[model samples]
Each structure stands twice: as C-alpha cells, then as structure tokens.
Target chain A: MMNPTAAMLVIGDEILSGRTQDTNTHHLAGALTGHGIDLKEVRVVPDDTGAIIAAVQYLSDHYDHVCTSGGIGPTHDDITADAVAAAFGTPIDVRDDARALLMAHYEQAGVEMNEARLRMARIPDGAELIENPISAAPGFTLKNVHVMAGVPMIFQAMVASLLPTLSGGKPLLSRTLRLMQPEGVIAKPLAALAAEFPDLSFGSYPFYSNGTYGTNIVGRGTEASELDAAMARLAALFPMDGT
Target chain B: MMNPTAAMLVIGDEILSGRTQDTNTHHLAGALTGHGIDLKEVRVVPDDTGAIIAAVQYLSDHYDHVCTSGGIGPTHDDITADAVAAAFGTPIDVRDDARALLMAHYEQAGVEMNEARLRMARIPDGAELIENPISAAPGFTLKNVHVMAGVPMIFQAMVASLLPTLSGGKPLLSRTLRLMQPEGVIAKPLAALAAEFPDLSFGSYPFYSNGTYGTNIVGRGTEASELDAAMARLAALFPMDGT
Candidate 1:
C-alpha cells in the first residue's frame, strides 16, 4: 500500500519578499512525517487570488491532502478563503457557526466584532471547520485541502486539530551517520551500500562549518530493523575513527 | 516599469521531509530583492527526477530567471543536472571543462577523483558553468535556469557569481510601522490608508509575543518619498498610545 501524499502551499508576500522566513513548512513537514504522510511538494506563492486558486486546484487533484498556510487573516491581502472557494466552484457567505465562534470569543474578551474581524466567518459551502485554540478565527477543510492562518502559532494549532482526522500509513523511520570525510570521498562507498539495499533510500547532505567539511548520510525506510542494518553497514563502510 | 521576476526551485528530499530547514530561499529572496529582482514564487520538491524536470521547465518558462538550489552533489541522489538536461531536451555528459575544474581542485587537496566524484562534471549541453568557490563542483546555467549547490555556503557563492550577470530594475523600498493595536482593531483605518495610496502595497503582519498582540504595517513601493508619506498617514490614523 502506498503512503498518503500531501502537498503544501504557502501563500504569503512576506515570505517571497524575504521580510519573513517561513518556519511553518518545516513544522508541518516534521509533524506530517510523524503521522506517516509524505509531504511530496511545497510551493510558496504571492498573495494573488489566481495563483492561489490554480495551486489549490492542481495540488488537490494530485495529492491525497493539500495543506495551505497564510492569507486567511482579517486584512485586504487575506483572500485565500475566497480563492479556495472559487477553486471548488462553490459560493461562500458569512456562515453563522463560524461567526458565533468569533463573536463569543470577542464578546468574552470585551472586543468588538467589526467588519474586518467578521470577515473570518466567511466559509465556503460544504466545508468543515478546523478549530483554532490559539485564536478564535477557525481554519477550514474543503475536501482534502486544509486552509489555515499565516501566523506560525495559529497555523500549528490548526494542524494539530486537523492531523488526527486524516488517515495515515506506516511512519517512515530514519537513521543518520555523520562522517568527517567530504562528499566526494564518501560518495563511492555510499553508492555501493545503497545498491546493496535497493528498498531503503540513502541521502548524503554535505556541510562546511568552521573550516570542517563532512557529509551526513541519512538512511530512511519503513522497517526499523532493515533501517538499522543499513545504518550499521554505512557506519562500517565509513568508520568515524578511520577518517 | 515592472521589475524582472524570478522563481526559486529548491530540490531536496531533506527539505520536504522536515529534516532540514531551507535557508537558501530566504537568502536568495533578500539578495534578489536588493538587486531589484522580484522573487515571485518558490517551490520545494523532493529529489525525484521527473518532478525536478517539470518544475525547472515550468519555472524557466514562466519567469525571467529561475534559480535552483540543491541536488548538485556527488551522490546517487544527486540527479538535478541530469533532470535539468532532460527538461530542456538536451543530453548530459562529463564535459572537459567541468572535469578539469574538479580534477585540479581534488589534486591540489590530495584527494582521489573517483567515478562518483567525477559525476559532478556532468553538465547539460549549451550551458555556462556557475563557479563554486567553496567546493569544486560547479553549478551551471542552462538558459534562464541557474542550478547551484544545495549547501548554504556554496549556494551563496554561486548566487554571488550569477547575480552580477543578470539585468536588474529599481530596488523595492519599504517602511514599516509597528503598532501595539491588534490587527482587528486597526484593519478598517489601514484599508482606508491603503486605498489612499494605490501605487504602494501595504502588508499587515500580526504578532503575539510575551502575551502581547500587535500588528506591523509595512508599506512598500519603488518610490522612497511616497512610501514615507503613506507610513506617516498610517501612524497618524492609529496612534500607538491612543489604542
């Protein structure tokens, strides 16, 4: 059986402009991996409605799940919800349940539910709300696509709420072996070991820091024992003390 | 006049797996912005050849320039060069110039240039090499797509070499106002201020730190004095102490 695949769409001009470094994709990747869902692709697009709509439609059709972050705020640039609705060919209006959640939260905090804040209540037809514990404005799931807030905290909260509801496959197990040798020297033996175990995936990541250069060989597989055996062979092939 | 647009394609399973946080995109974003190139989109795909080819082809076609980072190492998983060749309908092989560069560097460092190491010499047809000062493995530019090493330091060096060759437009200027008021409270007046300046783009980023919530309004434009005027209006409309 194949593992569930997911594609992430990050919608923010801040990220593309280099004003904001996105930590949300990394966070989602780790969490989704833990749940055995393969995050196949991630795209960061501008705050444009046409781009959002095209990306949402394409990713939703290709993958089992499509997760999106950003552009769901109470601002002029926050047009993700509307774009998503258009992608699904559905009409959206201020849904009462979502409005009640925002209204109650604001009422409790002694804040007014103004027009901008009320914009959060607009939900597309036939969508389920993903609860937001961090803030009252909820994210929603239209079919397989999950739309959440851009802020890291709110995005995380929505993911936490959304993950348990989806089906997952066996979690991918991984082990890394760090070598003092540069990638060129280590590449030959590593390829041999990789050929020996065709089922497992081996990745070599090179790093140069503080005048020390090395490669981290990562072995990933679904089976723990097989993964361990591969790491053992890798360690023996390029022993730390030998290099 | 519109700025020259660019798209970044980050190729690596490590990024998609959440094992590594991609710092290359952020670095490129800032550098490109400074050079007056608008980084419109960023896509992170796994080390799959077909995916890489598709992305490279699409991005190369859509934008003026497409910058790619990762998968330019001497490993079995390093297939970016081959994928890029296939995308452009060109054959790839070990070119004499690239091989000479790697051979010289390895010989100077007293390292053996094995078959695996020689893999770095493979360049697509009709491509120009992007010099790598950190490592000997040269990144190449085929048409508008600039392929570079995934390692941060090496990626930075290749970008430094490539940026000077590209045509750049006016640098984007920005001014930010940090307000203690929450985004909900400030959205109305902010929209009015945005309407007043059609040329400038306004972005409101909400933050929650140390149990305090506030919004940062960033005004961006090519015109310096126009950006300042918009910011001044924003400050007057929402005085910090008033809220």
Candidate 2:
C-alpha cells in the first residue's frame, strides 16, 4: 500500500476575512511531518455547517487521516463540536469524560463554569478525547479525524497529545538547492532530471531581484536516499555562480 | 445580491510537507479583501489531479470566483493547468492567444520554448488571460476564477490587474481593539455585543506571553456606520487601558 496520507481542515471565517492569521495549520503540518505522516492537503473554510460537513466528509474518505482545527471554543460561534457530530451523522451530547476534566479545570482555576463553558464538554459519540495538557478541555479523535482547538497554545498541546498515537509512514525528506540561476534558464534541464525520479517531487520556486539573483529549487520525497541523490545531481547541473 | 465571493486553491506539496511556508494565500486574501470581494476559503492540495479536481468542483459551485497558484511551472510536477482543464471537463489544446504571447516572450528572451513551457499556454476553455506584468506568460481567468503564477511578485501583479475589473461591495470596514485580557474573560460580554449587532462579524484572536497579557478583538462589518458604532462600544468597554 502507499504511504499514509493526512489532510488538515482549518475551520474559521476569521482566517479568510484576514481578521486572524492562522498558526495552528502551520504548526500541525510541521508536527505531523515530524511524526512521519505525509500531510497531503490543507483547507480553510468558514464556520458555516455546510462547508464544515463537506470538508470533513471529503478529507476523511480521501486520506488515511484527517485533522480539523478551530471552532471548539465556548461562544455561539464555537460550533465545530456540533458540526463535527452532524458531519458523522452522530448525536452530540455532553461527553462525561470531557465534562469532568473541564469542570475540575474550572474549579481549580476558580472560574465559574457556566452553560456556555460547558459547551466545551460536548463531543461526538464513539470518539476518544485527545488530552490537552495546556488547557483542560481536550480535543477528540473520531474515526481517522482529530479535531482540535484554534488557539495556538491549546491547539499545539492537543496535537502533541495525538502525535504519539499515530502510526506513520516513511518520513518525507527534502533538500533545497539555492541556485543563483533564473528558473527560465534551468527549467528544461531540471524538468528532464525530474522525469528520471518519478518517486521524488521536484519544485522550482523562483525569486527575482534586480540586485541579487536566484530561485530556490526544492526536491522532496519520502525516501532520504533519493532526495540526497537528487540534490547531488542538482548541484552538478547548477553551480553556485550560475555556470 | 451579495458581492462575488472567491476561494483560493493553492496547489503544492511543498506547503503541506511543511518545507515551505505558503505566502501566496495571504497575499490573495488581502488583495481580495481590498477589492471589497469576500474570500470564502483557501485550500492547499498536493499536485494530484484528483485532489485538485475535487477541490475545484467544490469551490467553483459554492463561490463566485476561485483562484489558484503554483503547479503551472515547466516542471513535470507542475500539473495545475492540465488539472484545471480536467476539472472543468474542457479539452485543453494549446490556444493561439497564449502560444503567441509565450512565443513572443521566448523570442525576446532568446530561449527555445520547450514542450514543458508550452504546457503553460494550455489553459481551460473560455478563459481570458490575467496579465502578468513581471513575466510575459499570463495567468488566465476562467469564469470567476483567476489562476496566477505561484511566485509572490507575479501573483500580486496578476491580482492587481483583475481587481479593477471585479465588481466590489462596500469596502469591508474593520476596527481592532487589542487588550491583554484572555479571550474567555471577554467572551461572554463581547459575544452579546456582537449578537446585538448581528450584521457585524466579530473575531477574537488570543495571544499569550511570559511577560505580556491580552487578546486582540477585531470587529468587521460591511457598513461603515455599524463598524463605527461597534468600535465606539468596544472602545468604551475596553477603554485604552482596560486590560
């Protein structure tokens, strides 16, 4: 079988509106890669249920694992818990395991746990809680999808909780050839070299400047040896001085 | 009717692999906002045609416009142009307009336009070119979507060309109040205020610090008056040093 693939669905209208710069998706992408899971796709949608359900269904079925971040807060806008339940066609009620943890957390912190605060206790059926060390309210893993918080610290902590449980594939490996040559000059030769290594993925990201010159050609693959060999070949073709 | 909404599909495995930070989406989101157009979603998919087609279909039907960046380069892995054609179910033969432009570009640059280069000239049917001022081979606008170069400079320029032609809504008005209060602290009251003005969209982005304290509460709305009133209320409640 092919390597295990993962996709992250970041749900929050705040991100698209430019009201918030999403850091959780970036964090999860890097964190998952370290655990040897190949992150294939990432999508950011609004808080709307229709968008959330569609993304959840698509990502879950297509990839080996799926992760969702945001919308797990206490306010009315924090509707991911309910939406996730609906996406799976499961009923969402207060989850006892989550409620106990949250209650204890609020009690120890001397904060009043209201009905809205209790909203964080709601979880979909047949899911296990992904512990949140930073905060008491936990993220959950349902089927292959792990749903986490949007807050950076909480999200990172929750992701950390889930990372240990994941059985990953050959970790993605890459090498960057920071060449002083323009993409146009090296495009044909690089394309020929890329065809030789179908297992590896080669990308040329061009950076143009009047004073300084060059583009960063990045080669990526699940195998370390392939990436190392490609880097060696890349160096031979395009030297530092653009020869 | 509401202003036309656009979604950006960023095609690259580099982004999901966490080797490269995707900056194009942020640039597009900001530019779309300035044009008074709503950016509905942003998805980063791998260079897989199936993934690209699925994302394209979902966003195309749901949003008025869909823009894509990356994967249109000379490399074999650069399959965005072809995948986009497949997505629309259009037979993507080389069009005269793009070929003429690309041929002129290659002649001026004194380079042989190879088969890989020609792939860029093959856009989806009925697509008009979005001007790329930095580079000659232009990005195309298929229906509402404008596909542009992955490189930041060319992407920005392409967006600039198309922004003028887009019918804009009342410029999205935004005012932010940053305080050192935890989001949960202000969540209840602020949510109530936001609900009172249902037209406005309120976002709370929380930040933590070893020495510093507070979250930045941003309020945005389509109407200037509503924004002003909300801003005034926020200022009054939070004050300059309320936190």
Candidate 3:
C-alpha cells in the first residue's frame, strides 16, 4: 500500500430513492485498503450529469486516483461514462477498443449488438478499457478515473483487476476485541491506550448489545506489534471476566 | 419515503488505509433508510481540513440534508468539528450548550473534563446539538447539516433521535430474486422486464461459479401491487425446472 489517495463517486437516483443498497462503495473501500491506497472520499448523486461531472472532476483533481461505481449500464440512469467525459471536458466517441470488446462479447453469446447494447461502447476519447472478465461490457479508465459496473460482483472484479496495477503503500493491519462495558466506563483508559500507541492508529468502534448489538473496541495500524500492544491495553481495561 | 435526500461524509484516513473497517457509512445508510430519508452519498475523506470542508459544502448544497460520520473524536485526527465550522464559514467557538452536555456526562462518569476533553464542546455558532445517548459529547445540527459521532452506535442513536422531527418521503418498496442464470443468458429477458415495468427500476446482478455468489434481480417502487406484479412477471420468465 503506497499511501496513494483515491475517492469514490456512486451515481444513481436508485441509490437516493432508497431502492438500491450500495454494495459497490463498501466493496471498493475494502479492496483499496489492501492496496494501501487511501479512499479519501465517497459521494453518491442521482443519475444527474451535473452532479456526476462535478464529483468526478473534484475527486480526480484532489486525489491520486478516483474510482466511480454505478450509472454505467444499458438503462437511462447509466450516465456515468458520459458524465466522466464531461467532467474532464473530453469528447465521447465509439472507440474501437470498447466496441471491439462489447462486440466480441456479444458475438461469443450468439447475440446481435443493438442500439441499447451499443451504449456500452461509448468511451471517452483517450480512455482505456478496464477488462470485465465476469461481464463483457468493459469498464474503462480515463485520466485518473476508473469506471466500473454498478452490480457488486462486476464492480468488485473490476476493482480487483485495477488495484494491483496501481501503486500503493504498505498493507494496514488491525486487531479487534469485544468490549462489553460501556464506552463511558472505558473512555478514560482507552484514551490513554490510544495515546500510548501513537505510532499505531487505535480507533474505538463501540457497539451497543451483542445478542442485539454489543460494543467492539477495535485497534488498528500499519504495524502488527503496535496493534497488539494497543489491544492488550484495551483488553486489560475491559476484561471478559465479568461478562 | 418523500424523497427527503441526505448525504454522508465519513472523515477518516484510517478507513482508506485499510487499517480500519468503516461501519459508520453502512450504519447511517440503513438508519436513514429506515427513517424514510434517502442517504444519497457517503464520502470518506482524510483528516485534511480543506478536503473535509469542501466535501461538506458540496454535499450540503446539493442535497436536502447532510450527515457526517467520523473525525469527531478528541484526537488530533478529529478535525470534523473544525471542518464543520469551516464548511459553514463560521468562526469556531466552544458554546455553552455543548459544554453543558459534555460536562453533565463527564460529571456523571466521575471524570474531569481536561483541555482535550473540553475540545469536544466546541460547536459552530447557531447550531443545535444532537444528543448522544451512548456518549456524553453530543452531535450537532448546523442548518440542514447534522454532524454526529464517528462511532456506529452513537451515530445511529443520533439519527434515531433526530429523524422524527425531519420531513421524509414514503418508504420505497423492493423485491429481489436470486437468479442462478448468468447475466448474459438472461440479458434479453431482463431488458424486457425493465421495459415492461417502466415505472419500476430493475437491475441484473451477476455472480460467480463457486456456488457462492448469486445475482439479486431487484425491483423497486412506491406501490406494493406494482412491485408484486413486476415480480410475478419476472418469475414467469424463469422456467420451473430446477437442479
């Protein structure tokens, strides 16, 4: 993981309509962590072109890389590709690279590429296709933005393929411990533990009840030993003995 | 829901590092959905004040409401409070209302409020504190922006408490089916399904061969009868033949 920074923009009104649960953002975040690239921001807007363009432009300019999920489908809501091009003030054309991929994909399945399906071929000028092994409609990389399918499986595959090629920092490590005691009871001691492990990032993710929801005190960092030391201190403060 | 829109800004570098698994974004999404308000966007940024302020300003202006998670801790990385003030272009100050909440909670827990602890009481001018039931330090609302604790439990509690007073749309309805078929095999039918149910949003998700992943063909709408009708039409497309 190289400390490279990135941002994710989720595009679709379905997400805002509460009709779609965004599986793409969570999956990307988890994958990016392994690469050691920091996901600095995530923004989801309706399939509105202006929102998508503004977010893509903002993130691309600010972060080392910017990844977008959703809105690149056959449907009308699939406006991500066009929006991304507009964001960079680039012209969108039916590039040979994307059309070949979409066509080959269609031919393999014994299908004719019609108007709706051709929408996948509209690539922004100077963009390269990110291989969609699972699905034939290839996602592409333009400037620093990587556009992938909205569906979680396709999205994850595209991200997995893209991550290894991207330079990143060291892999971050973590240690999680169950803390039954309330946060207020342990806040003082936990703060000391966090202070003691300045080299390691110790975040206290307190849960509510376990059978329903319980508090989990998690410690994390780039160093394993540092995480262990922090967790040890946290464990001592909130012991499992009384539970 | 009434199309009441909200966006989430998750402020943390720890998440991008893969050092921390962010639970706040998902938690807030679910909570807001339950309350019938759509969580349109979730942005995770580093502790950088400028980046935080930019995201806050963008989200607050575009959506009907904005909710931010993380970066509210006492540590130096906790720049959320400062960024919130910056987003509103207001001078930061430790208001009496916030100080009262933290003091009462600290007093009840028999802990002294030190300088670092008192920093939690700082709020932007003319903001209302969103009560934190789990921890004493309260979250606050500035205009339509609701700044809450990064911790999932506390963040959730803040939403649960604050949502009743806010306006929300009628909750959207959805129906999902696990399709064992490949995306390509069902592409035509799926496209037809989408066209048939023009008012309802339909999507085809793809999965892999490990007997693990399954594409959830989901349909969504405000009308239950319309959703049920779409589902029935979808079911008819699949032959009754089973493995």
TM-score of each: 0.97, 0.90, 0.75
Error of 3 at B218 (Å): 2.5
Model 1 scores what on Cα lDDT?
Answer: 0.91
Question: lDDT, candidate 3, residue A202?
Answer: 53
Candidate 3 Cα errors over 4 Å, as ranges? A1-4, A12-38, A71-77, A86-122, A151-153, A167-243, B89-92, B177-181, B185-199, B208-215, B233-243
Model 2 lDDT tens row, A160-221 = 78988989776777788888876666778888888888888888877766754477888877
TM-score of chain A of each: 0.97, 0.94, 0.92
Q: Which candidate is the best by lDDT?
A: 1
RMSD of 1: 1.6
Write the candidate numbers in order of decreasing lDDT: 1, 2, 3
Q: Which runs in model 1 stand beyond 4 Å of their true positions?
A: A240-243, B241-243
- Candidate ranking under TM-score, highest first, comes to 1, 2, 3
Misplaced by over 4 Å in model 2 are A209-213, A239-243, B91-119, B209-213, B234-243
Of models 1 and 3, which has the larger DockQ?
1
The residue-by-residue lDDT of candidate 2 on B1-243, one tens digit each, is 577788999988778877767778888777778788899889898889898888888888988888898877766677887777787887777788988988998898677787767877887778888887776778887766677888777888888888898888866778788777666666787888888999988877667777554767778888888888887787687765544
The deviation in Å at residue A80 for candidate 1 is 0.6
Q: Looking at candidate 1, what is the lDDT of residue A83? A: 97
Tens digit of per-residue lDDT, candidate 3, span A1-243: 347888888776656555556767767777877777767777767667887887888789988998888867654446789989998889997788888888887788666776666777889998988888876788989989999988788888898788878988876666767766544455567667767777776554445554433445556577877677667766776566323
